[model samples]
Target: MKKMYLSVVFLLCGAVLHGQQTPSGKVFRAGAATSNITPKIGTSNNGGMQDITIRSIHDETLARGIVLDDGQTRLAIVVSDLCMISREVLDEAKRRASEVTKIPAANMMMSATHTHSGGTACPVFQSEPDKDYGKFLSARIADAVIRANHNLAPARIGWGVGSEPTQVFNRRWKMKPGTPIINPFGKEDRVKMNPGIGNPNLLEPAGPVDPGLPVVSVQTPAGRPIALLANYSLHYVGGNGPGEVSADYYGMFANRMQQMLGAEGQDPAFVTVMSNGTSGNINNIDFGGKAPDAVLPYEKMRAVANVVAAEAFKVYQNIKYQDWISLSSAQKEISLGVRKPAADELVRAKDIISKAKKPIMTSMEEVYAQETMAMKDYPDQVPLILQAFRIGDLAITAIPCEVFVEIGLDIKQRSPFKPTFSISLANGYNGYLPTPEHHKLGGYETWRAKSSYLEVDASTKITASLFELLDKLEAANH
Candidate 1:
């Protein structure tokens, strides 16, 4: 009888210790709203034309850190409200943050919101000069990291995927036999036939659309929601008419979420961060068929933001927290072939340059022009960085540019983990990475120009590299 009692006691103690060994997470919110950067109004046909001004909005970074009781490993998810995150800059930030927090560099996953209306834009291609916007951006980003690290406390995390179809539309249009191609911006006077319409049978409707909106919520030990991170691929097009830099629709969406779950509302202590997914060819506006009579107003943009926020909250309400925690990460370098201008293509480019209407010259235009001239003298190769992180059941794969929906879906379909999300414009901006099909279609996204200098094969090679990283992560975990 004594031996049996001792054995039972030992079994109970083992169960209790195992249960207590689960890792805990914490949520931190930091924001810097002032970006001295202002848009160069009226520079292009797409430049600001309406009287929209940003008085005040939320431009935030949310960082979530997960640490095991043993402290052997730490993982963090840092989301920023910006157009892009350069690998060099992000590496420096990671080095600094890791030095301070002791978190491994590979364990840090940093991503951007891809907000076009945000602070000074980074260089998209080698043809574009690197903007000095980092002077103001670096300090703000570092402050966010410090604040997030300071707010670490015990928490529980839950994740779910919600669908919102009406909010996103395919911006690229396919050419069909006898199908009229309308102007993208809806000005009937601007309607013109697609210049490359000879091979009509080969062209198809724009790329695939990803309407999945994944929400990840972290709550305090006491059950108060501390932070919510939502991922989607739609490009931020709500602030076409802008002023001083702002976070565009991403800010609006966060505001709506705060109001819905804040103290005065549902009273959840929720801090929301909107992360951009593979949205190279995705937008809120449908560029196909007939164009609208007028541009989408700010009010319409706000409405769209609210709808997305509401759908995200719906997913948040249905989450179930898990206790199993495991972390893994991998990074790889990929080479994308250079798209050198052929002799004939150079002649054609010169012809277009001679006839194309030039906009008013500003300091910004002069800088861009100088960069364009320099690019003509050289051929450049784009380096793609693929990074992946696993936090329990949630897996994050980071790609360096605006990726097409098909590529995003392909990654998700092949991922060994559930609820996988691809964060785009993360760690770098190498322009749009369209699939082979979209590359053949030859639209604004796939066109190789001064601003978009990457070759079409770059997208394919990067996609393959990311999949290989995913496989390695799965193998390590098992």
Candidate 2:
């Protein structure tokens, strides 16, 4: 069945940057490294609202860093096998990396792959970030960047995109009017997430999917692969069964692709980093919940990794090396307000909260009830990190929330660069940022949890801010 699927190159941008010269004669240099980031025993898993356990390692989670330099300017990006990395930890990791490599804090972009099976990061609205694990992950990330900085050699990179519509999809669905479920606001909503299909009440999905798999590959002058980083807008393909700490398909995809595309040399050959794209409402599971044959947990992950990696190899073959390229990076802090419930609704929230003797969130609505009350303690406003990086005609945008595919697609469409993409779960975790229309429809994505707290128009504001930065980067090139 998988053989029947064919993927097309979404977009391919090939250009040169001749801004600076290096001793090696190549204008740009690249290097990559990976640091094992699997959590220690007893660390809490971060996939769900509950505190799930990590009994063992299905596979070692990793923090993969890639550094690119044009002699005069340098920037780094790190992809962690985490569910969601907290703002505090992300900032600290960037700070430490800067101290060693001298890459400005704003020039570093870090993001978790949103692997549900991975261990806890600096969580919001609760206990402090896991002190030991947080430090370990941050230190490892910084070290990886430093190592990549050390190993930097004259290199070349190319960009392209591929499609896997069957493997990646939107999980939001519109339900029948009569079937009403309680939303975070404690009111009925027309749309819901994962609305099972057997119920015949299912309508079309609430949103469209962006199955664009954009890849950026770095290689030595001789064309030996050094690192390949890809961004796909689908959320994780569920974790390794239960009780296992795996990097989910994101890691598996990278590992498998490394073998398929990697050239022989080092023990691991080259690093393969698969970064999660905007997928707040996307996943591999059959959310409509009606499939003739159900795929086993690990099997589904392997299938996704195989198909995606196969497509990436195809993109890899098309990229030709460049001797010189320009690099630029910038960051900004966007102020956003946490969404609040109405005054009278808060009374109802209190009533709902009073029923529970302890904090045990069962249903989705109950999860919001607890989170809504917790926001009373959160500052009225929060700072979100928005960043952009330019590699010739390719532009990268970093947003700190579980951004929906619509916003990502909008950025790509409106981008001045030929090939552009945005990454979510970078720099901070603020939950889901649905488009304005989805907020009005009211679904699980718009629900108030540790994940989705920003104001209704946050999607609009953040999108605008990101575009503004991209404009600056493109203008500077001129």
lDDT of every model, 2 decimals? 0.61, 0.80
Give the clash count for each candidate: 0, 5
Q: Report the C-alpha lDDT of model 1 over 29-66, residue by residue, as the tens digit.
A: 21111112333332211112122234333343232222
After superposition of all CA atoms, the RMSD between model 1 and the true structure is 7.5
What is candidate 2's lDDT per residue for 1-478, written digit by digit as tens? Answer: 4433322111111222232353335467888888888898777886777677678888899999899998888989999999889877777888888998899988899999988888789664333357888888888878878887777776878878887787766778887777777765658887878776575877778888988888898887677788998999988888377788888888888878767764535743488889888898887866665574766768878888899888888887887667678899867888988876667767777887777656666765566677777766677798988999998889999988888999999999999987899989998888888998998888878877677778989999998888889889988999
Q: What residue runs in model 1 are displaced by over 4 Å at the alpha carbon?
A: 1-70, 124-132, 178-204, 263-269, 287-297, 347-374, 377-379
User: Which pairs of residues collide in model 2?
Assistant: 10-161, 17-325, 197-288, 431-451, 431-452
Q: Give TM per candidate.
A: 0.76, 0.91
Off by over 4 Å in 2: 1-26, 124-128, 262-269, 287-292, 357-359
Give the Å shift of residue 395 in candidate 1.
Answer: 1.1
Report the number of the highest-lDDT candidate.
2
Highest-TM-score candidate: 2
